[model samples]
Target: MAASPSLANDNKSNVQRTKTSLSHLPYEVKQCIVYWVDRFQKEPHRFGSDSLLDQIAGGINHPGKTESRNNHPLLAPPSAQLTNLLNMHRFFHTTSTTNNDNKPSIRPQCNSILALCLVDRMFYDICRPLIWQTLDLEQFHLSKLRSLRTGGLTRNAEYVRKMSWRISVHELEALWPDLREELGANDEARKGQDWDESSRSTEILAILEMCTKVTSLDLDLRPTELDKQTGEFTIDETETTSKFFYPISRLTQLTSIALTTPLLANNSFTEQFLVRLIRDMSELQSFKCYGTDSVTPDLEGFSWPLPCGSPLGLHLSELTSLKELYLQQSDCFDFTWSKIEWAGNLEKLTFDGCTRNPLRTLHAFCQKFSTSLRYLKLDYLEYEKDVYTTLLEPTRDGPLSEIKSGQYRLDLPELTTLSITTELPIDLLLNFRDCKNIKSIELAMNPSISAEQIRELPCFWPKLEKLKITINTKSDLARCQITALKMTYWGKGIELEIEDEDEQYNSARFGHAYEDDGYDSYDSYHDDDSD
Candidate 1:
């Protein structure tokens, strides 16, 4: 206690001037700890890993799975609960690199927000809007439009709110070297093209007019040619429709588009620029489109005609604030769904590999969005196999038995996630046995679905809670994993998830099929499609 050396050097200079770092916290605690270290450095198994316990140990050989921590490999020292259960999963899932679609790509590793922006200037202004939100130019080049025009990244394009470009025609003739002499002086059978006054802006429309706050695009005009007999990039619809849809119809504050084209099924000038860019968006809420994987599950339905008095169903009923409509392998059954008076504010409808006659237009378009649908999916849907017992039997008659005795059973009442596939049966699950607020089911089941039709799905979804069930072989994925572990030990909290589609049908018979589930692989370009 020999204090007083000038009062202990002024209390060690007031404890080195109140030492605290992350720029002295509290800017909402340094933005919630830099938003969970930028989601633990971009989705570290959503903050806990070991590949989510090997995806809850259902990577097969079942008998209530969970045992292999790689057969006792952790020789000691790792504990901080084994380094937070290996959240950096062997340094971000085994050091990446697999691309040309064999999958495992993994690039975006922002080096923990560039080492928390070198720990200064308030973490480079909180990691500059998480590194300019998202501007994925899907392998785009022209030196990334000359580094978003003259190396400034167009003043951080208002922190781009999601984009995934891929427009083509050789990236618009390398951003208009007179765009192939203005498409051969505007006469390639001129239905539309008219950008004259010195080609009204080009470099991809000045980087999508400097991304004025994009709201989830994804564009991808799909013009890959290569295939000198199997070098790959096959589909090429002879490139024409790209005035980048006239600067993507001036964005109109897009709210989720998706597009990916193959000239919207035989291009009537890209189906009149996707019906005037979905009638100027009107704040579109999720549209998805997709189209060409060169469709096939016996390819017949592909109608688009329109233009007679074409209001395009009153411009898709003025969108009325649409909600999530996806139509992969596109041309969703030549619309006019009784002049589509909009899906009464639809909530997630999807119709993948759409071909035709789902009882002549999907049970009157799911009985006009059966009371605000909540996630319906219908995958690989090409009709006929006695069209779901001639549209749910009910003592068979014409015109779907007066909509199956009026209001045809699909009483959605705010459904809760159902995905289809086994080519619709189980008597069309009695048209969604009064959906009973279904909670996540995704079947794809085929081996003639029985174990008494999986014990009548908890007596028709009494609030079913998650069942996946993909199965296509390996002895019906071990007899549907012993009837989903006897419906989860009979207590029925459900939670089952099995997949094995015979290694996705031998990787879609070796053409290396990779549509990663959000639809399109109609059995990888169809060889008499079955599962």
Candidate 2:
């Protein structure tokens, strides 16, 4: 054999020569090929026609990724729009969408875009942006990011649509090694001082400038310091923290936002910061706010920016383009039903770990958007006294008392999925007697809920095709009986599961109740309360 160096050179020369003719292919044609390949490799079985060539090309890039015939009939049909949304959150994992179906199409797998990159130089250039579409600020390599932004490694900063970054006061010193001077006058002063505008806020402002195209942002800025000894998250009122509203307002393309910070509900400035930031995003579609544990804001106690007006409500109402809203791990005493104007257009609504609403608000909300609302998830909910009974009341020999109260028919014809976990009342299920379109229903509770109540769900939701429930019971006989009923439902084309879950943490993690487990674990903090 010739010298090893010459052998390697020859091999590289041969590989390069093979792709010399690829340039002859039209740039648009090359892009078109890569686009469909990217979709097939990552997308679900969307209801659209695909050419034979498309499938073959996609298979070349991703060998195993293919559609299956037996996807769960209950789950939503593979939506191209929803698949794109799912890809955006894969980087943040915390708020990722999940499919309970066993079929391969519903379950999105992480197919490496690297394989496409290896095909050729042009292929790499075309497919590179998608790989960087979602950036996790913490896990991302800081050195490569600058190169990707400005340097000639192929700047693809515009591709970053969804990004999440976490900032905790406990780790402030570590994050800003050079901010010691601003932190304090001396070593003792530095250690004693809390995080302020001069420290962490400046750094965040700089970071946001780099990713201007970010549409979905999960920003968790916990100004509160957690005492290691006592294991409590506390915020010092005296210290002044910088407002992100000004910097965040610059991200005009922002549509979906998950704002997880303790300051919003606890501090007035932070709440205003959120309000101003939201007011600017006229195109915002989905909004989720994570507040401090148990510090649910009461709608009754809120001081409106306008006299006798719900400022937050009014501010939210201005978001005419808004569609989805999720409020979790916070109370909504001030977030009344009447305040929301998106009721006509809102498609999805979720309320988790929030205080119960008055009967009138709940009923009016359900009725207002009954036609438009496709998804409703209520977990770790608290209901006011007699609220359930009032909603569950059947149409009697009374006049139309409330809107659409002809015979107390609370119809949600458009509702496809319903989740009721934790303090969610079984009577709420009964209220859905007119919800003929509901295909999926999730009900999980402690052993306190009776077997008869769970059994009666099928009767109310005649159209339900999927059911997930968890009940805690010590009796083996009880478990068997429940499992038997669940199987009976399953046999009737309703994909069903009856989890005899004993773990309190699992229940708490899934948004049942937050038990004081000394320190807050990741599950307890974020509370992935999806059903």
Candidate with the greatest lDDT versus the true structure: 1
The CA lDDT of each predicted structure is 0.53, 0.52
Top candidate when judged by TM-score against the true structure: 2
Q: TM per model?
A: 0.31, 0.61
Measured by TM-score, how close is model 2 to the native structure?
A: 0.61
TM-score of 1: 0.31
**Residue 405 CA displacement from its true place in model 2, Å:** 12
As a whole number from 0 to 100, the lDDT of residue 404 in candidate 2 is 30
In model 1, residue pairs whose N, Cα or C atoms come closer than 3 Å (at least 3 residues apart or on different chains), thus clashing, are none
